[model samples]
Target: MQFDNIRGFLFDLDGVITDTAALHAKAWAGICQRLGIPWTDALAEGTKGVSRMDSLEVILKSVNRQDEFTMAQKAQMATEKNDRYQELITHLTASDILPGMKDFITDLKQHNYQLALASASRNAPTVLKYLGLSDVFPKIVDPSNLTKGKPDPEIYQHAAALLNLEPGQCIGVEDAPAGVASIKAAGAIAVGIGDAHDLAQADVVFPGTASLTLTALRGKLEDGVLNA
Candidate 1:
């Protein structure tokens, strides 16, 4: 099956476009330690595409310490994580673009599909700026504008709206299950490009974007257009 006539494409950052999830994990764990909170990779992965406040809620709950942290403490902890995340990303260059992503993004633009940044990352602007691809996307909807986070479709829906395209006329590329659910729930095609277990909700799955040549993605884009 192919996704044809896709008027726009939404791409997630972090693990999708940057090899920075590990950095985020490191930062998050560091913040947890300062606050005497336990950290687990599963919690971090589970909350992968959520916003700061939402992620904090998940982490606190995961460690069975949600009730112990006051709102003020949570805010402080979230800020610490953001600061750490920013420090880690401040020096990332365009050389850090994910495998085949630069080529894939170039091919999509060559085909004239609209490109947008639709990520749960509140630091999308900083990260994009650091990567030197800030101008690559015409639309950007970070986590701040949405009341609900991924697995709820708010971010994807916002991106499609920003492009003035029907949800069916847009598609989302993501590496997390929550992100895949967000795209599908928003009525757009979802392409999962990462570990299968992490993207089980996606309509189509690939081992990694390295295997996703332009020809392959364009085929899927064509299908979305046809179906739209």
Candidate 2:
């Protein structure tokens, strides 16, 4: 599973590379409050790796109002959530980047590995800049512009295409099951950044980025290559 031969690395934002997942949860909670819907951690977890509109639909379903809102109204609420999320993340700093990520990314860059982003968030640019990481990824696939999100493979595939690499030549890292599935569907090796069970579909799972090192990742990838 050695990543030595991998040409590019695709990373998911929010929970995978930063602590912004909490900020996103807060925004979702705020929207739930205005809509009189009960928000819980279990419910919030369902929105990870999903587009804004898809997240809104999850919220609407939880409140039993999914059918009540028209497409226009849902779009407005999604915009409202994004506005709130933008404000909350305005105070983010370098400390917000997940532990070990900076070092790992630098290591990858030193090895001449191309970097790209495959996140479902439309605010990817803003968040990257807020965390002082706007330069790391030159290729970012905007899921908002696509009709499909995670689990559809479109985003990850687009990221690989933009990086001028085939999906099999790229490794996609994510913390969400849907994201892992998306990468796998795109023919890329999926590196899960969360609980192994939660990301069982991933080729290999690391507890978190803090526990991942360039050497260890390469070892895992090399092993996968051998096994395959």
On lDDT, the candidate that comes out on top is 2
Judged by whole-model lDDT over C-alpha atoms, candidate 2 comes out at 0.87
How do the predictions measure up, each by TM-score? Answer: 0.92, 0.95
The superposed Cα distance between candidate 1 and the true structure at residue 222, in angstroms, equals 6.8
Q: Residue by residue across 48-102, what tens digits does model 1's lDDT show?
A: 8778888888888876888997899889888988899899988799999988889
> What TM-score does prediction 1 earn?
0.92
Worst 10 residues of 1 by lDDT: 219-228
- CA error at residue 224 for candidate 1, angstroms: 11
Q: Which residues of candidate 1, in runs, are more than 4 Å off?
A: 220-228
The lDDT values for all models are 0.82, 0.87
Instruction: State in Å the error of residue 228, model 1.
Output: 21
